[model samples]
Target: FYKHMLGRKVIPADLEAFDPEYFSNLKWMLDHDITNIVELYFSAESDELGQQKVVDLKPNGRALPVTNDNKHEYIQLMSEHKMTNSVRQQIDAFLKGLHEIVPPELLSLFDDKELE
Candidate 1:
């Protein structure tokens, strides 16, 4: 009696009827959702830890200029810790000028507040 939805084409009988490019789109959306969820979970976990996750890639470096390589590194770190845009930009600039100047203790400057 109620196969009529499909019979009347209210809904497609095949998965592709819902979305022609189903699998690819579904996978992309799922991956994005998972990433967002993971970021949220990590953020909550970090709040519990009372510390932001830090990655010390370079050792004993002064004012570093934000280079393309450093930008890439910054992006990697940002994604890992879900860093903020302002913080990412600050770090990026620091890296870009690092060779010419010394960077202040970033963690100290951030004071437990880093952009995501």
Candidate 2:
């Protein structure tokens, strides 16, 4: 997921090789109080790979969606977390985003009533 946000493809072997570098770089940024590190990285990448290919990364405050097929897993997570209203709202927003992206037939497995 971090790789995806970084606009890189997810290859396990590549990630294994890259993780140490990423950590060290992130540590340096943090130590230096570099709040715009992501922007800087994206700027450099955009210079190399064209602006269209490098998306501006921002935190949208949304959790990754739980699709219809993952409803049970979401339920288990809710149960474990005691299902607060804030969490429910986060889950609902995520599911709503998934509804926009996922095929309708597949998304139908998500019980709308349950979301309410």
lDDT of 1 by residue, 10-32 (tens): 22223233345643443343334
Each model's backbone clash number? 22, 0
lDDT accuracy of residue 65 in candidate 1: 33
Compared with the true structure, model 1 gives a TM-score of: 0.19
Q: lDDT for each of the candidates? A: 0.33, 0.36
Error of 2 at 108 (Å): 22
What does candidate 2's lDDT look like per residue over 49-76, in tens digits? 3333332222321233434343334333
Against the true structure, candidate 1 has what lDDT?
Answer: 0.33
Query: Which consecutive 10 residues in model 1 have the weakest lDDT in total?
Result: 1-10
